[model samples]
Structures are given as C-alpha cells and as structure tokens.
Target chain A: MNAKLLEIEGLSAGYGAVPVLRGIALHVAAGEIVTLVGSNGAGKTTLLRAISRTLASRGRIRFDGRDLGALSPEAVFALGLVQVPEGRQLFARMSVEENLQMGAYLRRDAAGIARSFERVYRLFPVLFERRRQKAGSLSGGEQQMCAMGRALMAAPRLLVVDEMSLGLAPVVVDQLLGVLAEIRGEGVTILLVEQDVFAAFSVADRGYVLETGRIVREGKVSELAADPEVRRAYLGVAEAG
Target chain B: MLFAQILVNGVLLGGLYGLMALGMALVWGVLNIVNLAHGALIMLGGYAVYFLFTGAGIDPFAALPMAMTGMFCFGYLLQRLLLNLIVRSALLNTLLISFGLDVVLTYVAQWAFTADFRAINPSYAGANITLAGITVPLARLAAFAVALLLAGLLWLLLNRTRLGRAIRATAQNLVAARLYGVEPRQLYAVTFGIGAALAGAAGGLYGVVAQITPYVGTSLTAKSFVIAIIGGLDNPLSVVLGGLVIGIAESAASLYLGPTYADVISFGLLVLILVARPARSLRMA
Candidate 1:
C-alpha cells in the first residue's frame, strides 16, 4: 500500500499578487511528525493555510492520495486533514463546552462524538474540568489546549499545528509538547510550524528550515542540528550542537 | 391590582415582541450582518398573512404556515441572489444594500397593500381569560404561547441537530462553519429564510395585537434591534427574555411615563447597550 500521506509540489501562493510561498515542495508519510521552522513572515502559516484551502494557491497539493488544493477548508477537513490555525481563534462568547462541540462541527455520529469527547477530556484534564466555563476566560495555555482538543474532535488523519508554543511559558510549552508527542504516538501524521527551534527539533522526527518563504534545508533533526551552517542560520549559534 | 394587570399585559405583549427580535437575533448572530431591513421583513410577513387571511378565507391561524412558507421563499431568494452578491464586500456596503432593499420592499408593500393599517383579526382575537383579577386577551396569550414555542423549536434546531450546530459554527466562524460540509451560499440562504419565516410568524401575531402600517417598519425594526441587543447574541430564548424586559419597561412607561416615551426608552437602551459594551460587540463584529 502507498504510504505517502501528503505531497506538495511547486506550490506558489500569497495574498493577491504578492507571493509568499514560492515553488514550495514537501511530503509527509503516514504517521510521521515533520516540523517547519521559520522566522516571522516566512510563509509557514500560509503553507498550512493553503493546504487547508484557506488561501488561493497555484500548486499541486495531494493529501492522502487526492488533490487538496481544489477542496474548500471544510472539504479538506472532511478528508481528515484539519488545521489548528494560529491565534487560537476560539469563539470567545461561547461556553467552553459549546466551543468543544464545534470541534465536531462536521460530524453526524453522536455516539462516536461522545466517545471522542471522553478522549479529549482524558488528553487535557483541564478542559474537562472547566467544560462549562467560557473559552475566552481560560488563560492562553488553556485556550491553546482547547484549540488542539477542538481540532482533534474532527478525527484528523493529518494535523497541522501553527505556533502551538507562541505566548506560552516554558513549562506550559513543555506540557503541550508532551501531549503532542503522545498524539504522535497514536500514528497521526503531523505538520508542525513553529518559531521555537528547540521545541520543533526536540519533538519532530525531521525538520524543514524556512527562510523568507523558501526552504533552506531539510533533513533528520539530528543531522540538521549537527550541520554548522543550519545551526548558525536557524538556531542562532555558530558552534555545532 | 392595576399594576399587576399592567405587568401581566406587558409580559404577554413582550412575548410576541421577543419573537420579533428572535429572527433578527438569529440572522445577526450567525450571519454577522445587522439586518437593517429586519423590521421591514417582519412588516412584510404581517402584510402577507393579512392578505392571505382576508382574501383567501383561510383561517387566520391556519394561514400562518402558508404565510411563513411564502416569506421563507422570498427571503431565501433575496439572500441567495442579492445579499450574497455583496456578502463578501465591505460591511458598510452590505448595510447600505440591505437598506436599499428595505426601501424598495416598503414602497412595494405600500403599493400592494395601500397606505392603510392592517390587523389580522381572527374571530378569537377578542376572547379573553381572567386569571387572579388580571384579564388575559386570548389572542395575546395564544400569540405569546406560540412565540415561546417557536423559540423552543429554534433552540432545539441550534443545539440538538447537526444542521443546527453547523449553523451555529458558521455564525461563529464562517470558514469553520463551511468546513463542516456546509455550503456557504445554501447555508446562508436557509438561515436568512428561517429568520424571515420567524419574523413572518411574529408579525402575524403582532398584527392582531397592535397596529401595523407601512410606517410600522421603522419602529418595529428599531424594537427588534433593541431587544436583540438587550438579549445578547448567544442564545435565542435570552432574546425573548430581553423582549420581556423591554415589554415590561414599555408597559410601565405607558402607564406612568406615558406612551410616547416607549420608543424613546428602547432606543435609549439600545444606545446605552451599544456604547457600554462596544468591546463585546466588537469581537463578534
């Protein structure tokens, strides 16, 4: 059986005419965790958005052996390729439970949804504890967890996370990374975008370094960490790790 | 005892008023468009029901479903063809277009129905019940009951059903709502149609209780806006309670502060609510 889960070739996209992601090419096998590390405005979020069909792009995006670029965001989600967009855009006025219920927005099987809620609760006990609270009332860390939990409610085969570590303390980031690692163990393909080089490398099996909307280097995390130039450019260190 | 009667009267009338705001709330909450034409749509519903009952000899109560169905179709087409064209445009532009639609609709209504008052006077319109020294107009009571019933139905649609959930999701985030396999055009059309239908039903009830004329559109639209804001945008029934609040306030105003200030009070409340909670409404907008 074919194992390639997602393949992007010559993907070019941007807001109107100002192109951001230029001729980007990448692939992810089933159940592999890949991280894209880039500085601000490097088009990492745009790439994820393009895959989710939230942005207009000219490229071939094949997800789980099907063209994804043609599909709308909802259609893409139906295919089990969901994106947890940046900024944790939870419906603030909605109760935490209502917000979570939205995660199963496209689903019909109530029984399975009930079971998924149980799983989500098990994953993040804080969300379960404050199920009735307003989502906006939750702190930033909790909101991020809620965002992840909401995305998981879709039963995604591939999860695209944008800046999960942003505006989070080290301890909170560590906790989130741990949960992500656990999610990875469940054989879910992950495309992680982050500015935190350390966290991205720590959890990702392989890493793609993006500089100003272009891929500069792609390799195994260990191998990339050992390269002097990659270390200097991406990690802000000249010495080999 | 007189005060008690006044309060009961206010509560009953408030139920229908809440119903009026319910549609506006639903459309505004989910569609993210403060439908300036909402009251006009309600007025149209009233006229539709009025003509159906008076011309066709259909029982006024029975004619409701037919009127609702007609309004729903009209609203659906309006949204799908006209409103959808500028839905993606600037908010100010959408508001102006809806306002224009309101003007056209008001003028057309005046031409068809003529410049006169209309009330859907079923035989049962005058029947009343006395409970604990308070006289309850049977029509008003029935209208209030139906109003609550409709609100209950809406609550069920939005919470218990998948389609309802998608509607809600769409309201919160249009993209996310679409991600749930909902067609934006179809979904939006359906939502607006439902809103119109609710307005039609409310207008039918309201016509029996109060005077409705071509000019009624401006005030009813303002009242709906006031109730919707007072009720907040999250739940449908809270808006009914909001209506009740306004209803009681108006009742008290009529008895004590005089009737002319009723509109003033609600509009004042609207201004206060909008100004005080600009942050709250800002996020949703």
Candidate 2:
C-alpha cells in the first residue's frame, strides 16, 4: 500500500455550540480514490469543511504527515490539500480563463502554469471552447467541469471534492467519473464526498459510510457495495429474503 | 462664452471628483466596507503633500506620489490591525466602526494642523490656458489629466495583472479565494492600501484646486458616496464618469442658479437616481 497522504483522528467540528461532526476518523492513502458517502445533512459537508479548515474543529488532521490544526485554509492549500467546494463556487463574473488563472494563484512558475493550462484544456475541451465566456453563463455540467479543471490547475497532491454529482445528470456524472479515474491514474489522490453512492463507488478504491456526525462503516468499495446495510441505506436496495 | 467656460470648469473638476470616488468604490467592492474614514484619509493626504511642499521644498504635483505612499502605509495598517477585526461583523458594525475612525482622525488632524485652511500654491497655481474663448486653470487641467491616468492605471491593475485576478476572485468568492491559497487578510490590507493611496492622490490635487482644513472631510466623503453610487463599484473608469456627471451638473447649477446650489443639485441627482432605479442602486451597494 502507498503511504498515507491524509489522516484524521477523533475530529469533531460544529457551528457555534451545535456539533455537526463527532469523532470522525478517516485516512486516504497516496494514489487512492476514497469516497465518503452519506445522505444529505449527514455532516458530509461539515466533515469536508473541517478538513479544509473553513470550519473550526477539534482533533488531529495530518496531511502529508504535517499537523493541520494550527494552519489557516490558505496554508492548507499551500501544502497541496486543495478543495473544490460544494456548489461549484466559480468566480461568476470572471471569464473561464480567469477562473482557471485564479486556481494557479499561488504558483510563481510561469512554465508550470502554462503546462497546467494545456492539461486543463486537454481534459475539458469544452472549457477551452468557452475560455473567454463568463463562468456564470456556463451550463451546470460545464460549471462543474470548470470547477474540477480549476482545482486541477493547482496541481494538488490530494484533491478533496465535495458533492461532485449533486444536481448533475447521469450521463454527466458518468463522464466526470471517467475523469476522476484519469486523474487518479496520474497519481493525484482524491477524497470524493458524494451523496450519489453508486457514482462515487464506481471511481473510489475505498469507501466510508457516515451517518449523523459519525463514521458508521469503512472498507474496500466492493465490500461496502455488497454490504446489506449500505445497500439498504444508501443504494436503495430492500432487505434480502 | 460664459456657458462654454463653465462647462470646461465643470469637466475639469469632474475628473478630480471621479478620482475621489475610485478608492471608495474599490474598497466597497472588495471589502464590502463603506469606509466612513475614507475622506479623512484624503484629508491626511492633503496635509502630507502640504508639508512635503512647504517643509521639504517639493513641488505640489511632485509630492503626490510621496503623499500616496504614506497614505498607503497608513491604510494598510488601519485595515490589517484595526479594520480586519470587525470586517467579518455585520455591515452596520463596520459602518459604525469606520464612523468612529473618521471622528478620531478628524479630531487628531484638528489638533495637529491647528484647524487652519491651507492650499498648495506653487508658482503656477494661478496659471491658465485659453482655448476657443474658454480659459482653463492649468492646475485643474493637470489634476484632471492625473485623475484619468490613475483611473486607467487602476483599470489595468484590476484587469491585466495576476494580483488583480486574485483581488477580483476574492471579491467574488472569499471561500474559493482561500482554496487557491489567497490569504484574505493580506489581500484585504493591500486593497485597502491601494484605496488609501488613490484617496491621497485626490486629496493632494484637491489642496491645489480648492482648500483643505480638518473639517473638509465630511462634505468630501458625502460627495464621494454620491459619485461611487452613480458610477457603480465594478469599474474604475466608470467611477470617473460618475464624477464627470456630478461635475457638469454642479457647474451648470452654480452658473444657472447660484454657487450655493451645487451641493443641492448633486444630492438631488443622487436621490432621483436612487428612487428611479432602486433595484440597480441596491445591487451596486
């Protein structure tokens, strides 16, 4: 197995006095595609926020073996733990090219940035076609693609994508899943959080089931897919006779 | 002939007015802070230029960059140490804090500068150029040209540079900006510093064209608000256009009615614009 890239232990986070995530422990190994599958309001977003340091949390979050508790969100990003947030928060007024430029904001290497632009254009030709168009004017699927392309421009060692399949059609989700596989093949570890368990499981190597602020189950994707409880709760399969 | 001269005077003054609003519009756009202390920053800029001219033997126009640099540092510290604390608070809270800052700055200026009315009067202060039966004050023309140049520079900064892209991104989505490794606090300080520098430049020009006292900030701040509203907060050049609208209106009002009607005309225009398109004004704000 590859070395662990991100490890979280006993992580608890919440808004104000209300707890959203409690004692959530998960780890993603380098070059692995891991999925955190949960229904809406199961604290999936809260967990992602905790890892990104956008939400205040208490526990040990070690990314690439460095403690993340004391670091700011930008500092976490500098360490190559980038997050493509929920809702595909593109700079709506900016052009597609400018949005991608923002993704490479921290980098000073002009040649590397040029290469990233080429790679993003290769991955999503639609983005290239609409490079000068305003980001807000893009279709929903295209916006999601732009968001992913923007994150990829960062050249992140580990990407944390939140709710990639939300509001997307089946075909679009399939295409995005194919890209996720391609990204993993390039050795960038992915922690994909999704409510669409089937779509997530198709791309992920390992899976974790979260319910009401706690990790209920975790294992290889095949094991979780075959489990009766996961099937019943998430996959919408009725109990076997 | 009188009409043409008044129009020329109005247009010249309008450019400076637009420069005055540029900083406020920028700060409002990015930080979402109305910055009641903005005019005081302008006042401080006037004083800096005044002292540099009188004490250090620097020309008023030449002292502009020096004043702008000083104001930039002042604004950077103001945002980094004080304003950043209350930045995440409610809009009303920011308004109140900035209002308090304005009062403090005004009082401090009154104490230090002795409430004396001072104007930057170089040897060419009264020089004028006549064209097509219209006489234009050389200083005012120079001030207007500088205003347009600065606005163009600001436009280039926002649209052409990497730092500009980061700022625009941060203004649109703070969370996304953080994801791309932008430290909002540092960016905020830089933006505020730029705003202050612009205000300083405007202030120095104002001292040359008009008068400067500790009490000048209030009316200047009010004028800036009107221009910023009319211009929209998105573009620097647009703010200058907004200033021109006010300048022409005021000059015409003073010519047709009386000098006292200038403020009345500007504020009245603001009210009419706000009432006519409440939705647009609300969105801009």
Candidate 3:
C-alpha cells in the first residue's frame, strides 16, 4: 500500500453546538481513488468540510505530515489538498476562463498556469469553446466540468470532490467518472463523496460506508460490494448475486 | 436654456455623487459591511486636502492621491484591528459598531478642526467654460472628469487585474477564495482600504466644489447608501449612473420645487425606490 497522504484520526466536527461528525476516522493513500458513500444527511459533506477546514472541527488531521489543525484554510489548500465543493460553486458571473484563472490565483508561474489552462481546455473541450461565457449560463454538466477543471488548476496532489454526480444526468455522471479515472491516472489522488453508491463503488479502489457520522464499514471495493449486509442496506440489492 | 443649464449642472454633480457611492458600494458588496462611518472617512479626507493646501501649499488635485494613501493605511488598520474582530457577528452589530465609529470620528474632527466649513479654493475654482450657451464650471467639470476616471480605473482593476479577481472571488465565496490562496482577513483589510482610498479621492473632489464640515459626513453617508442601493452592486459604472439619476433628480427638484425640497426629493426618491423594488434593493443591501 502507498504511504498515507491524508490521515484523519478520531475526527469530530459540528456546527454551532450540534455535533455532525462524531469520532470519524479516515485515510487516503497516495495515488489512489477512495470513495466515501452514505445516504442523505449521513455527515458525508460535513466530513469533507472538516478535512478542508471550512467548518470548525476537533481532531487530528495530518496531511503530508503537517498538523492540519494549525493551518488556515488557505494554508491547507496551498499544501495541495483542494476540494471541489458541493453544488459546483463556480463564480457565477465570471467567465469560464476567469473561473479557471481563479483556481490558479496563488500561482505566480504564468507559464505553468498557461499550461494548466491548456490541459483543462483539452480535457473539457466544451469549456474551451465557451471559455468566455459566464459560468452561470453553462449547462449543469459543463458547470461540473468547469468546477473540476478549476480544482485541477490548483495543481492538487489530493483532490477532494463532493457529489460530483449531484444534479447531473447519468450519462454526464459516467463521463465525469471516466475523467476522474484519467485524473487518477495522472498520479493525482482522489477522495470522492457520492450519493450514487453503485457508481462510486464501481470506480473506487476502496470504499468507506458512513452511517450517522460514524464509519460503519470500510474495505476494498470488492469486499464491500460482496458484503451481503451492505448490499441489503445501501446498494438496495435485496440478495447478493 | 435654464432647464438645460440645470440639467448639465446636475449631471456634473451626479458624477461626483457616483464617485462617493463607488467606495461604499465596493466595500458593501465585498465585505458585506454597511460602513456607516464611510462619510466620516470622506470628511477626514477633505480635511487632509484642506490642510495640505493651506499649510503645506500643495495643490488640491495633487494632494488627492496623498489623502487617499493616508486613508488607505487608516482603513487597513481599522478593518484589520477593529472591524475584523466583529466581522462574523450579526449584521446589526456591524452597523452599530460602524455608527459608533462615525460618532467618534465626527466628534474628534469637531474638536481638532472646529465646527468650521472649509472649501478647497484652488486658482481654478472660479474658471468656467461655455459650450452652446450651457455654462460649465471648470472645478465641477474637473471633479466630474476625475470621478469618471476613478470609476474607469476601478472597472479595469476588477475585470483585468489578478488582485481585483481575488477581491471579487472573496466577495462571492470566502471558502473558494481561500482555496485560491486568498487569506480572508488580509483580503478583507485590503478591500476596505481600497474602498477608503476611493472615498478619500471623492472627498478631495467634494472639497473642491462644495463646503466641508465635521457634520457633512452624515448626509454624504446617507446619500452614498441611497446611490449604492439604487445603482446595484453588480457593476461600478451602474453605481455612477445611479448617482447621476439622483443628481439630476436633486437639480430638477431644487430648480422646480424650490431648493429646500432637494433633500426631500433625494430622500423621497430613496424611500420610493426602496418601497417599489423591495426584493431587489433588499438583496443588494
């Protein structure tokens, strides 16, 4: 197994007096795609928020051997753990190209940013074509592509994407999943939170089942897929094949 | 011809009014701070230019940038040390705190400068130009030009520059801004500083055309808020246009409905606009 790139131990986080994630422990190995799957309000988004430090959390989160507790959100992102937040929060009024530039905000390397722009444009040809159009005007699938492309411009070593499939057509979701595979092929690690358990498990190397803010089960994708209880409860498959 | 002359005057004055509201709108749009003390900052800027002209013998126009720089530093510290502490508090808290700052600054100005109305009387103050029988005062024309120039510069900054992009991004979503390596605390201070600098420029121009006192800020602040809301925070140029609307409205009111009714017209328009576009105006605020 590759060395752990992100390690969270006994992570607990909540919003203003109510605990959302309780004693959650998770890890992502370098150069691997991991999926965190759960139902609605299962603390999936909350966990990601904790990792990104967007919300206050209590626990030890060590990323690339640095104590995350001591770092601000910007510092944490500077370390290359970038998140594509839920709902594809692109700067709506900004053009697609401008949105991508925003992802490269901290980078002073003009050449490198230009290169990333090429890479992103090549990956999402539609975005390149509509580069000058406002992000809000784009179709849902295009917005998701822009969102992922924006995250890529950050040059993330470990990319955390929440609900890449949300509000997207199944075909679009599949296409994005394919892109995710390609992104992983480029040696960038992925931590995906998806409501579509089947789709998530199909693409991920390993999976963690979150139930009510705690990890109920976690194992290699094959192991979790074959687990009868997981199938019955989560996959909606009454009986294992 | 008289109506046309009044219209031209209003247009020129509107340009300055737009400049005044630009800073308020930028800060309000980005920081979500009402900045009730904005007019006070403008008053200080007027005094800065007045003193530079009287004591240091500097040209009022040249002193504009100097006052802006000083006000920028002052705003930076004010936001970083004071407002940043309570930025995450309730909206009413921010409004109350800013109002308190306005009172403190106004009293301080009164004590130091005394309750005196001073105008910046440069050699060009009385100069005027007549084109097609519509007379234009050179000072007000210069003020109008400066206002448009500043607005143009602001538009360029927000749309063309990297720092401007970060500021706009921060305005939209702080979390996303951080992902782009923007530190919210520092960025907020920088934003407020820019806003204050713009206000300082407006003050310098305001002093050139009108009289300034410690109490002038209260009304200017109210006028700025009205312009900001009517203009919409989406674009800087639109805010200036909003100012023009008010300027013309005031000029027409004073000319036709008596000078005493100008204030009533501006405030009345403000209330009517707010009452009419309840949702759109409320959202901007």
Candidate 4:
C-alpha cells in the first residue's frame, strides 16, 4: 500500500471557548479521495481548518512524513496542502483571471504558472469567457468552478474542499464531482468535507462519519453506505436488511 | 481668469493632498490598519528630504525617492514587528495603538528636527510659467504631475502584477490568501510600507509648497482621513479625484469665506456628506 499522505491523530480544536473537535483521528493515502461527511455544525469544517493550520488546534498532523506542528497557514500551504474554503471565497472585486493568478501567489516560475492558467481555463471554459469579469459577478456554479480552478492553480498535493455542494444545484454538484475525479486521476489527493452524504459517497473511495465533532464510523464508501445507522441518520433512507 | 487660476492652484494642491491620502487608503483598504501615525510618517519624510537637500546637496526632486525608500523601510519594520502583533486585536484596540504610535512619532520628530518650520528651497523654487493667462509654479506643476504618475503606477501595480494580486487577495480574504501561500505578516508589512512610501512622496512635495513643522502631521492626517473616505478605498484615481474635490472646496472656501474657514469648510462638508449618505463611509470605519 502507498504511504499515508496526511495523518491526523488525537486532534482537538475549537473556536475560542466553544470546543468543536475532540480526539479525532483520520488519514488519507497518496492519490486517494477521502470524504468526511456529517450534518451541519458537526465540526467537519473545523477539522479541515485545523489540518490547514488556520485555526489553533491540539493535534499531531503528519503530512508527507513532516510534522505539521506550529506551522503557519502559509507554511502548511507551501507543503502543498490547499483548501477551497466554504462560500467559494473568491476575491469578489478581482477579475476571474486575477483571482486565478492569486492562487499562484507564492509561485515565481512564470512558465509553470502559465501552464496552470491554461489548464484551469480549459477545465472551466466559462471562466475563460468571463476571465475579465469581476468574480463576484460569476454565477454560483461559475464561482464554484473559479474557486476550484484557483485551488488547482496552487498545484496542490492535497486539495481540501469544504462544503462542495453547499448552495450549488444538483447538476452543478454532479459536474463538480466529475471534475474532482478527473483531478484525482491527475494524482492529487482529495479530502472532502460534505453534508451531502450520498453525493460524497458517490465519488469518495473511503468515508468517515462525523457526529458532533467525533468520528463515529470509518470504512470504505460501500460499507458506509450499507451501514444502517448512517443510512437512517444521514442518508434519510430506510435500511433494506 | 482669477477663478481659473484659483482652480488650478486648488487642483495642484489637491494633487499633493491626494498623494498624501493614497497610502492611508491602501493601508486601510488592505491591512485594515487605520494608521494614525501616517501624518508623522509624512513629517519624517519631509525631514528626510530636507536633510538630503541641505546636507548632501541632492536636488529636491532626486531626494523624493530617497525619502520614500526610507519611509518604506520604517513603515515596513513598524508593521512587521509592532502592528502585526496587535492586528488580530479589536478594531478599537488597533485604533488606540496607532494613536499611541502617532504621539510617539510626533514627539520624536519634534526632538530630532526641532519645532521650527522648514521648506525645501531649491535654486528654481521660485520659477513659474504662465499658461493661458494663468500663473503656474513650476515646482507645483511638477509635483502635480508626479502625484498623477504615482497614482497611475499604484493602479498598475494592483491590477497588472502578481504581488499586487496577492496584496489585494490578502485584503479580501486572509484564509483564501494563505491557501495561495501568502504569509499575511510579510504582506501586511509590504502594504504598510507602500502606504508610507506614498506618504513620504507627498511630504517631499509638500515641503516644496508649504511650511513643514513637526506639528503638521495632525492636520494633514485629518485631511487624509477625509479624502480617503471621500475617495472610497478601492480605486487610486478616485482617491485623487476626492483630493481634488477637497482642494477646490478649500480654495473656494478660503477665497470666499476666509482663510480660517478652509478647514471648517472641509470638515463641514465631510460631516454633511456622512450625515446625508451614511452608507458611503459607514462600511469603512
């Protein structure tokens, strides 16, 4: 088996006084698509934030054999872990092209960035058409595409996407999932946090069921889909067995 | 013809005023730092140019870049080492700290440069040209041109460059910026440095036109605040236009009312605008 690209153990995190994540542990192997699914306010976003080092947390996060302790968010990003945060937080006033360029802010190689720009434009052709338009003007689906494109511009090893389907139409969600698979085929690891259990299970190889900040179940997506508790509580589907 | 000349004078002075507010606007827009000490930084820039001219015989125009570079370094270090520490604190706290910084910087300038007024008087300082029956001071015209050039350069930097994109991105969303591998601390310092550099340039030109004393920062700071609000935070050109509006207002006020009412009119307009359309400036502070 390939080595674990990201390993989190005994992680705990929270906003100032409101503890959100407690004793959580998870891992994703190289080139794997891992999904973390839970209801709203279940600490899914907080876990990703902790892994990205954007929030203060107590944990041992070993990424690519390096300890991610005491690293700033930028340092964590330099290690090739990037997050497409919730709300498609594109610089609203900036043009789509400029927003994509911002994704490569730390990079100095001109040719490499140009290639990334081409790749992103090809992946989302609408973005190419609206390259000069302000990002805020883009539709919800377009903004989502721009956000994903922006994340790709960073050439991330692990793309952490939070709330992939939030505020997106079903068709757009399916389109994004297809793109995620294509991205995974390019050898980038994906750690996705979603409230849409069924949607996440469709693309994810492995899954974790988080309940109020704690991982209650961890298994292959097939097994998770079969789990009666998960089906009843999250999938809202009746059990066959 | 008299009105046209007054308009030109007001516009020229307004150019310098716009340059003064540019830094404040950038810092406020990007780093969310309302640098109360901005005026003091301008004073320091004036002193820097004054010394370079008096002691080293460098031309005042040539000394402008030197002052900008010096102030940039000073502002950069001040942000990296000091301001960043309290940046995550409450807005009121940041405001208080900046005010404290203003006090300290003002006192230091007073100690080093003395309380006497100084001006940058080159050999051609009194040179003038008459264009279409309007008398224009050569230095003021040059300063006005420089202000426009600087504002244009700033617009290009923000729109056409990667670093500028990073700075703007950082301003819009810190978390998103980090994902792009931007270290906020360094970026914040750079933004503040650029703001200070603009202030320095403004001060350098200001010394050519007006008297420079250690105490000039307070009123200048107030003027900058008004201009920044009038201009809005995003566009550099708008900020310059905002400065022009104030310049014309001041020129007209001083001419029609009295010299003493120049400030009163400016402040009064600010209050009127804010009270009338609170939506404009409310988002900023």
What residue pairs clash in candidate 3, if any at all? none
Best by lDDT: 2
Model 2, residue B122: distance off in Å is 1.6
What stretches of model 4 exceed 4 Å from their correct place?
Answer: A1-3, A9-25, A55-60, A70-72, A239-241
What's the residue-level lDDT of A122 in candidate 2?
A: 88
List runs of model 3 lying over 4 Å from the truth. A9-25, A54-60, A65-69
Kindly give the stretch of ten consecutive residues in candidate 2 chain B with the minimal lDDT sum.
B276-285
Q: Best by DockQ, which number?
A: 2
DockQ scores of the candidates: 0.45, 0.84, 0.72, 0.75
lDDT, residue B150, model 2: 96
TM-score of chain A of 1: 0.95
In candidate 3, chain A reaches a TM of 0.96
Task: Please list the C-alpha lDDT of all candidates, in the order they appear.
Answer: 0.84, 0.92, 0.91, 0.90
lDDT of 2 by residue, B1-285 (tens): 988888898999999999999999999989999989889989999999999999999999999999999999999999999999887568999899999999999999999998999999999999998898799999999999999999999999999999888888888888788778888899999999999999999999999999999989888999999999998888898899999999999999998999999999999999999999877665642
Q: What is candidate 2's lDDT per residue for A1-241, written digit by digit as tens?
A: 5799999999999999999999989999999999999998999989888888878899999998999999987788889988888999999989999999999998999999999999889889999999999999999899999999999999899998999988999999999999989888887899999999999999899999999999999999999999999999899999869
Q: Which ten residues in a row have the lowest lDDT in candidate 1 chain B?
A: B173-182
Candidate 4 residue lDDT tens string, A3-110: 999999999999889899999999999999999999988898788888988788997999999999888877899889988889988889899999998888878899
Q: B1-285, model 3: which lDDT tens digit per residue? A: 998999999999999999999999998888888989999999999999999999999999999999999999999999999999876468899899999999999999999999999999999899999999999999999999999999999999988999889888877766677767877898889989989999999999999999999999999999999899998876899999999999999999998999999889888988999999978776642
lDDT of each residue in A97-133, candidate 3, tens digit only: 9999999998889999998898898788999999999
lDDT for each residue of candidate 1 in A193-232, tens digit (9 for 90 to 100): 9999888898988888887778888999999888888778
